[model samples]
Target: DTFTEDQICQVQEIHVGKPRIVATIVPKGSPFKKMMIYG
Candidate 1:
């Protein structure tokens, strides 16, 4: 995966009502500045 273990953990913590949605985490200027999650 593009995300690290900690980054993955951060994504897992997020909760939403929709089954399919996009998630963007981390700050700008970093390698993983933008992340897209869809499942």
Candidate 2:
């Protein structure tokens, strides 16, 4: 999945004074996963 430029910009603005938003996609039984942090 991809985020539009506007969506990304909006998220960036919201992240300015707070901790970044972290997203993870894990399988049903996966213990390890990758995360994407945005600010």
| Candidate 1: tens digits of C-alpha lDDT, residues 1-39 | 497987877774566566887666667676565333222
Query: Using lDDT as the measure, which candidate wins?
Result: 1
TM-score of 2: 0.29
RMSD of each: 16.3, 13.2
lDDT of 2 by residue, 1-39 (tens): 999998877774343585787766767655454332221
Local distance difference test scores for all models: 0.62, 0.59
Candidate 2: worst-modelled 10 consecutive residues by lDDT: 30-39
